[model samples]
Target: MKKVILRTVFISLLIFSCKRKQVDIPIFSYSILNDSVKNFKLNVNEKEPIIHYEYFHQKDTIKRLFFKYNSDKDLLISNLDTFYFNKKTYNSKSLQFKFYQKKEINSHKRFLVFNKNYGLLANLAYGSDYLFLKDSISEMDKKLLFKALFYDLNKIETD
Candidate 1:
């Protein structure tokens, strides 16, 4: 009986110790009018969170997003609301771009993922409330809240 009790306690301790822990890391995304740098830090992780970022590099200008599931393959631009990319620069200045598959509403702001794109987001200076508009790479930046919005994985190409 004594031996069995000791074994049970040891097993319990081992199982508890081996359990994975969840941590909360703050992130950010942005808008042009709000140029004051509010230090907005949204968090992401074990619990699902929306991760997003704006991209503006010569030709591949975009406002990217990642919904539910910790990680998922990046998607191609299914639709291009070219009202902002003024034929010269990849600028999204003052334009509240919208994103979704079957939902509605234009986005005012928001990168994403720690394991893969943490460095990039961090280099953008650690925040989702950011903007990166224009051909000049003014790098419009801001913070994005992880709200688990609407997304269609079927549209995204799998890796």
Candidate 2:
């Protein structure tokens, strides 16, 4: 009887240890505006977040995106939107642009998984307050959230 009880306790402990732990990561608020010029912003829940202008354009079904100045940082322009290149610079500053395209195999599946994991409400009634915990967000979502909002831009191809 004692051995049986010990086995039960061990199994319980193992199961508890394997459970997923919730974590609170900074949730980024994303937005786009159109007023004579198109603008985009992604900011954490903070004041005075750094602002940047990123571009995305699709040509012959091949999509590409670029930052005003090529930066390999935590934040990048989302490739989900359409951007038209303007021959103008920001603040009179010239930009050096490098571009990339998406290369994920099951992007649609990944996106659905992301929404499910994150509990993202697409059609929630406005002004609904909820406490959301960020945990186990998939690699695809993380890249989309931080790197680019599109898909695998890491895979390279050449003619």
Candidate 3:
């Protein structure tokens, strides 16, 4: 009876003490992304709308972002990038976001994505772009978000 209790306690401690491995999310960069993926093609096929375009050592998905917004009236094949810490503002608490602006030019197509995890609850594009940090991020943030997204679609790499 004493031996059984000791063994059970030992096993419980071992199980509870072990930590599970966590998947690492890599920082967003143009180099880490695939230059030639079509959002629509992959979005319709996946069980979930989100797709993992970024890989770590080709081993596993490092990070994922909201990849598809399927509104016909609004921007089609549109995606959102992750919020980044605002370095210019010198505020570590402040975050800045980038949006993927998709376009068709001369019948050629390209997909450019760079984002961190954005919650659907706040995605108003799908009637879910809620105010993530309602107190910290205000209506002004939306204006800034649009301005950044409105920039030129893609600046091809000459190198």
Q: Write the per-residue lDDT of candidate 1 for residues 1-159, one digit (tens) a residue.
A: 999999999999986665333323333333333544322332223222323332222222343332332234322122332111111111123333233221232553212212223312221112332332112222321222211211211135453
Question: What's the distance in Å from true for residue 31, model 2?
Answer: 1.7
What TM-score would each prediction reach against the true structure? 0.27, 0.27, 0.25
Tell me how many residue pairs clash in candidate 1.
Answer: 33
Predicted structure 3, TM vs. truth: 0.25
lDDT tens string, model 2, 1-159? 999999999999986665443323333222221112212221122112322322222122232222221223323234353222222111102323222222343433112101212222111112321111223344444333433322222334453
Model 2 residue 159 CA deviation (Å) reads 8.3
Question: Alpha-carbon error at 17 in model 3, in Å?
Answer: 5.0
Candidates sorted by lDDT, best first: 3, 1, 2
Write down the TM-score for model 2: 0.27
Instruction: Write candidate 3's Cα lDDT for 61-129 as tens digits.
Output: 443343343322222233333332221111113443333333433343232323333212122232212
Q: In model 3, which regions exceed 4 Å deviation?
A: 17-128, 145-159
lDDT for 47 in candidate 3 is 19
Give lDDT per model, in order: 0.29, 0.28, 0.31
lDDT of residue 66 for candidate 2: 25
- Candidate 1 lands at a TM-score of 0.27
Candidate 3 residue pairs that clash: 82-115, 82-116, 122-128, 122-129, 122-130, 123-128, 123-129, 123-130, 124-128, 124-129
